[model samples]
Target chain A: MKARIEADLPFYFGPGRELFGFYHPAPAASGAAVLLCPPLGAEQIRCHRLYRQLAHALAEAGFPVLRFDYYGTGDSAGHGRDVDWTRCLADVATAATELRARSGAQRILAFGTRLGANAALDATDAALAGVVAWDAIADGAALVGELDRMQDALKVDLNRFDQARPELDVRLEWQGFETTEHLRAQLSVVGLPALGPRTAWLVSKGSDAVSEHADRQGRSVEAIDVAPRWDDIDRLEMAILSHPLIDAARRRLREMA
Target chain B: MHEQAFRFGSSRHLVGIVGLPPVIDHGVGVVLLNAGMVYRIGPFRLHVDLARRLNALGYPTLRFDQSTIGDSGAGGKLLARPEQVVADVGEAMDLLHQQTGCRRFVLFGLCSGAQNAHSVAHADPRVVGALFLDGYGHRTLGQRLRHYLPRLMKASVWKQWITRKRAASGPRPPEPAFVVEPLPGKVVGGQLADMLARGLKLDFVYSGGVSRYFNHVRQFRECFGRLADHAGVSVSYFQESDHTYVLRGDRKRLLDHVAQWMGRHFPVTRPG
Candidate 1:
């Protein structure tokens, strides 16, 4: 396969260069940039391929894109146990500034999936032209509850092989990554902030409450049919490649630009 | 430790992260391959953790995705997947050798990655050491007995078996995209013998995740016969850990075991 004209540049940013990200520069400048906020832990992993594709698409459409790992996740410098909602928000703001500098874009739109969408909304950055919240978590407590259920189901599935296996400490972990009680407590109260006029809320068909909430705030809401099964243990290895979602986000971001 | 991300390969489309230690005490760098569709950070970031741990011990490490996976772009569509993977790994070794002055290398992988590592190690002379996690394995008589005997004693197994029999048949689940085709015992034995004869260090770790194919410590010997008895061949059976080392405790145990094995086989000669 032929390489793209604009090759992505991977580098570290943030304090002490602790945060890792890739800068997908637009071949032709649109004066706008997109910052991608990844979901935490395993969700971030499963959606990695999709995110890369999204970044490439956005860049091809003349929007420089910055896809990054929040502190204490992925190739970022901090330990997994240290990750928290507060750190994620701060990282988002830092990444926005970095993206603005790297891409020389005056307007920066943020696109986040799952919990990362929450971070994008919560982050207070003036450079942010808008935010695209895809399957954004409306309730942190509910997300935690779903994660707990998934972990329990995983344990049950594994028990088929070894019945004597001891219960994993769910409070300290969700899936395979390390988590902290502090993080869980912080996540429990997380709610999407009041939507800005430019903010677009993309939800799966079932997330009516989130859609209604966005509509009540007079923000754009698009209900997508193909929701990514990020937490499914059976399809853990399958990468999320929802063309509909990608196209929707691309179209929305183009409109914003 | 310092970690830097860059693109390698002839097209410079393949992305990788190289973890460098404060001091380079060993010439053989470790290359962590992608496990299934999981990216370079590995499932649960096992590779990043392991890379940093190994770096702390002064062994440089590189974790990258092959073409058409993760951040890496596609390779030549003309080449088969296996050939592309082997070619990608050779390019990874070339990058490490050029950047770190490491002439020798140790390849590490999980599941599909393990199979790739084995193949690459067999093909590339620069690969002086290789670690395979849940790699190739065939069911041995002892392994089958150990796996099924406990289930036979459990009433729940029989109950489930009956329940499944009574249930209506539906669509069968699609076969997994990546399956390790077990090599013939003779073929594996001959390959291991050749690698061992070249003074290559080999480590194999089988988790409880692969219990269907491999169970008990002796299964390694049962499957490979006398070749598994080689001093250079180290085998670990984590009957409690799953295929991906999902649990924090299991992952810690694995990381510890890998570090110990690497230290024992490829000691850092210079004082860090």
Candidate 2:
């Protein structure tokens, strides 16, 4: 068995706010730390176990790992409607700082899944040594459009509010979590920007549109086509790990001297 | 209701969250165990919702991961052991007793968690009641007939049988099997009898997904003999719900039912 210490605690990122996270400290100092930014809403619920497994594997491989829920997600402090893409990026930065201070690591890495990947690339700080974007959403407008399609597909009567009534917040509720109008608009404008990290890996389905966009903006990214095992609607209860994606991330982090 | 995160156990590595009501219920609190690989939050945040509802109804609840599961780190052992799970539940109970002066407890769990809760209720005298959701039990001959007979009548089954594309696909890929260990049906029945003999309240809730083994509402009675009709034992079957209660409506129904069951069987009265 691998030797590691897990601390499940909340840290104050704002004056009156606290964010919950799990800190996985490696047995020996690896001089490098990784902050895992998770996807929001139902995706976060589905991937919680896999994310923990990734953190454990990373810690066992001698890297300090910190995986946390954004302000309004998981066991964190806020409600579902309070989360936005901007605040989530700030949460990532706060997590990176905490990981560095706790692990005494000089360099940091940001790894994210889906929309979390978007946040990681957008929130690259000066201390970031590498970035791993796994099946990231390429364009926010397209994502919003897809969400609209999903809402339409549901075709069920809304509990109270309706899209026909423009006065109310045009909310989209997926698997019990709702995205308010303000957050929805913010998400509509999000896309991968040019990143500063030299070491980067982009894992996507068949194509790396986000990385290609980043390349156009002068950021080099090594893209790997690996199909994700995520089903946004269907609840996946199995404890299966994506070997290819994990292996790719492990190999990339290992190469980040 | 308020929630606070904490780590308990000798190593202080087991992580849990305590949901407390406005007033402390010093006599009894509910301890929710992990179901299969699902974390303490449960599928679709069911555990979180259930804890809040229980607390609002005056019963504090503690939901946590075992030594090597969820947010908790590995506990020197690689494979999951039932004995370890049982001991971890005891530690959670001890923590609740120390923090809020809760002496009596109600254990609640689903699937493998239900099995573990059953084992713990039989082993520990402190548990006043236990709720098992989609727990294990043997299928009767009538149950087998009711379950398999429906599949033969499905249009999709006949289509598959005629097309045989599944056969031509060269053996369909193996699904990732659920790894949780199940207690034998006889053993579970015996343990339930023992718990009831000691005056422990028990509730067995089932979903439509377990229809293969538990086809009808009366199957529990048929399988457990006279023990099923015991005053201490209660059984509920939600024929429309899945194993994990994926549907939001189903989850809400489950929460409501569990809360009502607790009110009737394991009501918490705060000590004045």
Candidate 3:
């Protein structure tokens, strides 16, 4: 029998910044801790319920989990104007350190979805035992292009009637959330060469960019195909737990353990 | 405005953010309830923006997650009953009252949140006013004809009808699921009458998202009987905006309207 304890606390990740997070402690230590990195904008709101469920499930499986919002997002301190890749990368590293210190787990696994997976890949260091990147973006330019297409699909043109368009330095709007030009530049050229020995690249159906990139690098990667439910614009509020996806990720982690 | 995160409830499991202005001796404060499964932040973080604006207006607000939702832990159970939600809200009011000495409160909620706020207002005497966005509204016979008659006279409707008739020979894809659950009209009407009789201020707003059931401005009275005509009750419909004010302009309009309504009904005054 496993009893999980959950706490909502703030992580002093940086100077004058506090990131909000929920820590789910397992009944017994599996010597491994997981940090959940959420995606940005509407995707974060839509997948929040699923993330909580995943945290609970992982805790039950003996992996202490910590799920959090990036700085300037969710319940965290700071404004939208401050969101950038540098800050996001630092936040991830800080969250992992906090989890390691709190859970006393010798091994650490970072799980990220979408842009979060991109951040996870960038934040991965020697201490990270393994990584589970779900629906990751391998190329930053492609990610920005996809976001542009998604915005067009949603019929959102923030500057449609503006006779005078602002410069590229101005922030861009993504599905009602603000993104700075600095963040856009960083995301335009992101690349994930290949994962280390213990890495899983979960790609959506009809797209294997990450897997192909890994293969091109002459590296072995666990490429698992899943539906792109995270990008679903319609059912963003519906908490549809994909058992197959969860089971696949779980199997990979179990093998690592 | 000063904002702080705190927890209060049985076993201190409910987590909430209390927004207080520089002055804390206000008599009437505000409490924002959660909308369905959406957390205390409300959809698109609307509640946060609303609370900040209200605090600037010198009215303290407390927005919290119901047990089993958001940052709050489950109250020793997986599912929370309706009564439990009301109790949690009452506890929030109690906490705010103890903190600010506020005796009167105005409840704000949207969608399922509107239902919860209405329920709390009905049960708690401290709730002086309630603002409901995209709340429960029903259609009347006249409204039904008014809605369909225009389409009946449309050339596109007839053309679509003929096209569908021609395509009826082929297999039809199952109609996609569309869930619509409107609250009971009679019960809401009775409650409205009672609240109005006690001098309770009511602001009920419906956006274009709920136009399927409530389209016309006069539909409230027709649907819920004459009780909707009470001077204490105000009904408004934003036909162009959706259920959640996704557009920035629409949200500004809503906030302005709410600020004006709050000023008129539950004005925050300096303590003597």
* Candidate 3's TM-score: 0.83
lDDT accuracy of residue A209 in candidate 3: 74
Best by TM-score: 1
In DockQ terms, which candidate is top? Answer: 1
Q: Give per-residue lDDT, candidate 2, residue A246.
A: 72
Q: Which residue pairs clash in candidate 3?
A: A141-A188
Fraction of the true interface contacts (Cα pairs closer than 8 Å across chains) found in each model: 0.53, 0.14, 0.05
lDDT of 2 by residue, A85-135 (tens): 788988888888888888899888878888887788788553577777777
Higher-lDDT candidate among 1 and 3?
Answer: 1
The CA-based lDDT of model 2 is what? Answer: 0.74
Q: What docking grade applies to model 3? A: incorrect
Instruction: State, as a TM-score between 0 and 1, how close model 1 is to the true structure.
Output: 0.95
Q: How much lDDT does each candidate structure score?
A: 0.84, 0.74, 0.72
lDDT, residue B147, candidate 1: 83
How does model 2 score on DockQ? 0.22
Query: For model 3, how does the per-residue alpha-carbon lDDT over B155-209 read when each residue is reduced to its tens digit?
Result: 7667757876889566444534423354578887788778888889999998766
DockQ of each: 0.59, 0.22, 0.20
